[model samples]
Target: MSRRHLAMLTATVLAAASLTACGSGDEPGDGGKTLTYWASNQGASLEADKEILQPELDKFEQQTGIKVNVEVVPWSDLLNRLLAAATTGQGPDVVNIGNTWSASLQATGALVEFDDATLDKVGGKDRFVPAALAAAGAPDKPPAAVPLYSLAYALYYNKQSFADAGITAPPTTWEEMAEAGRKLTGDGKWGLAVEGANPSENAHHAFTFAQQYGGEWFDAAGKPTFDTPQNVAAVKRYVDLMAVDKIVNPSNAEYAQNQSVSDFANGKAAMLLWQAAGANLKSQNMAADAYGVAPVPFLANPPAGGKQVNSMVAGINIAVFKHTKNLDGALEFVKFMTSDTEQVTLNKTYGSLPAVGTVAADPAFAADEQKVLAQTLATTAAPLPQVPEESTFETLVGTAIKELFADAASGRPVTEDSVREKLTRAQQQMR
Candidate 1:
């Protein structure tokens, strides 16, 4: 299963009381010393998350003398629960947010923006991975959150399947990938597993493919560029895997990201586009030697200066609700969570990359997949556009791809004109 790299929620209004409540250290019913934290579930289950995090919380409390209340919220509920709390001027002192939502949430004025002085308290901005920190918020403003954990997408292929098909190496260009896919498809199996039903997963792929084809999602002024000719071509190319190239299974239109990963792990498909799928694949009893990792394939005929790119720097970020009464303690906890010790411990257990650069030296991250992701992060990967409407972009663009997938699956014509129509509607809607 794909890890919950980001869980975008609809932005909501913060209560009137929240404006003054934040950073004030003044609330009526509770003492300011106790800090409340809403942690995203990081382990197999909510209970498992609690077990993993409580010991760390205990250590923090012992050192700081601040009582900490912890709640493990499932991904489905975390956003709405935060909305409810913000509406009531009552929420956790610190909480986890999808890094991509930082800009959207920042627009609501609900999260604390870390300034130079406050950032200094957390060991300065130099401690974090540059690409990871860049995803926290916009370039011109203080970031609404700081990266907590990180991830990048990679190509995961079935080694035995490749050997059986007589392919000695993973394809480096899109043309070679298509050729390899054609050769790998047969005997009741597919060459590639695609996640058509999962909108976010589709959106992530759109970003990578569009970028590879020299298509930008937003113009210089940050206006929607959804229907551009280049983007249309990119979307068509992706859909062609099923509709034209016939390398992917048409039935895969029903697959979500998890189902796609399952297909690859179970030998129903030869290749998968995924991030940090190791732990989940292991859970499904897949052997380590069965699969191999490679950089995501790029375009064979990229425009001048264009190079292969993979994913937006994806991960969760930790933010403080600006309205928390225990201002000092909340800030302290933020520092503690992003500290070197905790970053290593949490990311190690979660099967994710650490936000802090120094922590990457740990042996736990020395796997081949981790190395490829690390190289990509340092070289070609980028964050989602740091615009206030990034979440909307994800929703609108993802839905467009979903519509295309539906057409291909149902035997409807997926013409360039139809692609433009869907994309234009999504673009105009964004206006």
Candidate 2:
């Protein structure tokens, strides 16, 4: 998200577009030919994803008379691979991208911008959840992608642990969460698990916490506000779980989201803040009845300025490449992927929610965890900031939190002064 990284990405996309456009003789029409797709791995493995999605692609091909080639890309390599294709002008016709990267990727002009006419081809903006749609691209710009899948964070608590601790229900506010943590901490288990080592995970929780404290990461003009008093307080509250409250393990400074979630599933921790982790828990042999889901905690008594907004719309989007030789086929493929039947089948395999509002009416989504998260995405979630530098914001803020955790783990002093000092440095670096 650094300007340097942005510059590098732009250069890669532009250079690739130019070279491919000049080097290749194929015009911008598929003429009812084959289409290549780069799908993010949504199942246990690449082969597993193929097993789940190839049938759907086969359906699309049979119905549309277009042969489809899919390459399942892992999460770690998707962006870099896309960048390489962008730079070389050899990327797939369609791709899946993290929604947070939509605006950033759009700025490169290597993606097909979905105008009103094209949007109608995919059932229009009205078909999708407004929040998820908003995240497909910047507000002022035509979207380069459409919402394909959706997710939102919620508190996942161990039901048995809560009952043993004499807690009747999941905590609805920060005060109660802390109290619950205290009660749940005495049996060789911590009350909460945190992804202190994962920048993206930490940055997301920071966003929710900052909003609850009535703080904004950016001004209307998109200036960094990382050092605001409310933001400082929110961050201090997060670190205190380890430093002051002693409810989180001090060594959690090295724990990523997967590790934290694993701890929660294995009963090493009583609570976890996660998004749609039901499948992973099931994989770990945690029974469906062993856990309960609730809204992420917010301030019980939000100070005069605080608000109760709880989550950010978190998920992936479907995008088409502008340089594809088969533009029409690519468009058709996008439509097929977003269709009601495909949406349900695909999201079911991914353990995520459908991006389309009407596509979510199935009773399967009414189960406890899915229902709570779907409700949160509909009622309380906000999109991450749409500015071009949003990724930069994540890296800076997430790194600062990681540093704070390291201080706690090392038994160093963690005062407000230290928090302000680190945050101020991050703000200055953004300039």
Candidate 3:
């Protein structure tokens, strides 16, 4: 899922409460001809997503005589809304979910499990990408959802900024990236833009950094190991980008709503670490040729246990609520959405890679940006720990990072001790 739509901690807690209250309910009548869908906001704006999706819904309606009433839910309210629906059994028949929430939501037992027999209704298990499928739910359990759109993080750099800085190529190592950032940071322009205040964004970077630092957020039992030495070092390293390195603008410490993306689009920043940023850039009027894409940088010198991973498996998944009266219509809609034709069409418009394997060779996804993201997703990306507590982990740990960013932006020293303190508090809360 894009960082742009990650829900806040409070909303997640409320949703979690609602999920605990979920129970089997009597099915309501829908006449078996209509389905309600709650889609994530994937475009530049809510209206933009509706404009892009309504046509496809209409196409499905024409083909199957089943109408889809779609609502583009903002990330802030999506999880809460879904949880309420799960508790009351009165929500949309079909919904889009952040892939990381698969295990957490699946634990509610309110979703229809896509076992082999159930999957046969929608193309079959072989039709999807393996990595994407793996993220749909916990291992050894039938997935609660199927991959809809695929994404991975990449480094987006301003081509002109690099040329002006006399840089010949994009950085492949973190040290090189910092060096380049130094050169790019002058004359009112900053080296990079980061969404410092966004907990979801912070957690995503934290996960990647922890992997590169030979750390894990959870142990073998799925318990949080957040305040470990490796994790402390990882969190400190990220906040130091502003507090110590001085490469990022201090003002960015409060950027939770994609102001960093705006900065990159307007050339106020030279680089961005983001997932599938092309469509968003285009929406901001940044030309296709204005920037270049490359795999996210890794450590110049990794520790003993450090992995080569650079990104987390990130994307959206589609699921059917078990309480839906129109189960057949809902399954048909899932089939329609994940079909190869729709995969190419929708993924292309959203600047995401197709989740279905059959569309991997489609010419629409042959662009440079897509290639970089595809390579990362296939090679270096690892999914977040697929535990039932994954959503709470995101909230607690992500908010910890957010608070640390606040300290950095406010001119406070960001030491390993401070990082450890924040992480320790988060872990304590999880208990």
Candidate 4:
């Protein structure tokens, strides 16, 4: 999942953090028999992730005689924590990172570069899915990490709610979606649920909308272009769901903690735009059959430069830190986790697509939801810009949109001018 970004870490802070580094002394003193790991919270909760991973970790220990000390990190703190560890060289031997942040983290030069030799130590570079591996780092460079789980966003709608509202089928275009959403709204139920307060979630949608509107957040030279007319229109179009279309609940302005998913599962909302939401819904006691998945809608009339993109290529990556003393053990662990058997096991449990190609034909991934995600990933989803400043772009633009959502919820007008002004401020901050 995409995570909240704390303020950008200044170079001064990084230098200061580096001054206290003790040169690989953070490794366990047990002769590399033990390794520290920081895992992103992938399950319903941090504890839930530990429960799911402990057995797999134990299996690795049995096979390799190396014990992993794992700590599940929440999305809210993961980025900042990672930055501290990256600068100080004093944390996990291995870590899980949001795939979009791969390039940004790589800029610190704290991650082990997966060159041909290093990749050979694990599995060959060909083991991962091409699209997934493409997002692991900047283009034309050795990946800073390897793909672990793959995801693409889809529109999930309550089947019963659609039927009750007399809607015949899922929307194929933005206009149809808004019309459907209007019909779905009434009787204390909203047409759509959104994680408006969440910066990362907001950024993901912004990227997709900007794509459909023929907008580019970054120019050809990889500079911020956040306040262009196309982008302003795109941002306005999204906030209008609450501000103008009135299909989303105003209370969604405060939903940053997956509360939008809960609202959808509980029938308080009819639709959700999310990445691999099935596992999360099931955890909320929602049955598999309760919802139908469809491709996220596109513009009915796209502009001249519009792209067919619908979702951002979303997933997690596993990276080994340069400071790791147990390089052999860490590579072994990576190989074990990405092995075909483990890929199927973990992806099935998380409702995510396997990052490796060998598991594509597995029966465990043949579900309807999986099919939709697979199709999207194979066809239309684009990765967020894999530039060194991508994470900072996510933070600045996402927080700006979050503030716009807050305004919309507070009964303030969300106009094109207001949207442009907010985006301009975000662009200025990037400079």
Give me the candidate number with maximum TM-score. 4
* TM per prediction: 0.86, 0.87, 0.93, 0.94
Q: What local lDDT score does residue 232 receive in model 1, on the 0 to 100 scale?
A: 88
lDDT score for residue 98 of model 4: 95
Pairs clashing within candidate 4:
none
lDDT of 4 by residue, 291-383 (tens): 999999999999999999999999999999998887888889999989998999999999999999988999999999999999999899999
lDDT of each candidate versus the true structure: 0.79, 0.81, 0.87, 0.88
Model 1 C-alpha RMSD vs. true structure (Å) is: 5.2
* Candidate 1 vs candidate 2, lDDT winner: 2
Question: Residue 8 of candidate 3: its Cα lDDT?
Answer: 37
Model 3 lDDT per residue over 371-408, tens place = 99999998899999998778777778888988888888
Q: Which ten residues in a row have the lowest lDDT in candidate 1?
A: 1-10
Q: Could you say which candidate leads in lDDT?
A: 4
lDDT of 3 at 28: 44
Instruction: Please state the error at residue 352 of candidate 3 in Å.
Output: 1.0
Ranked by lDDT, the better of candidates 1 and 3 is 3
What's model 1's overall lDDT? 0.79
C-alpha RMSD of each candidate structure in angstroms: 5.2, 3.9, 4.2, 3.3
**Model 2, which residues run further than 4 Å from truth?**
1-5, 8-36, 41-51, 65-90
lDDT tens readout by residue for model 1, 338-370:
898898888777768899888889998888888
Better of 1 and 3 by TM-score: 3
Clashing pairs in 1: 22-322
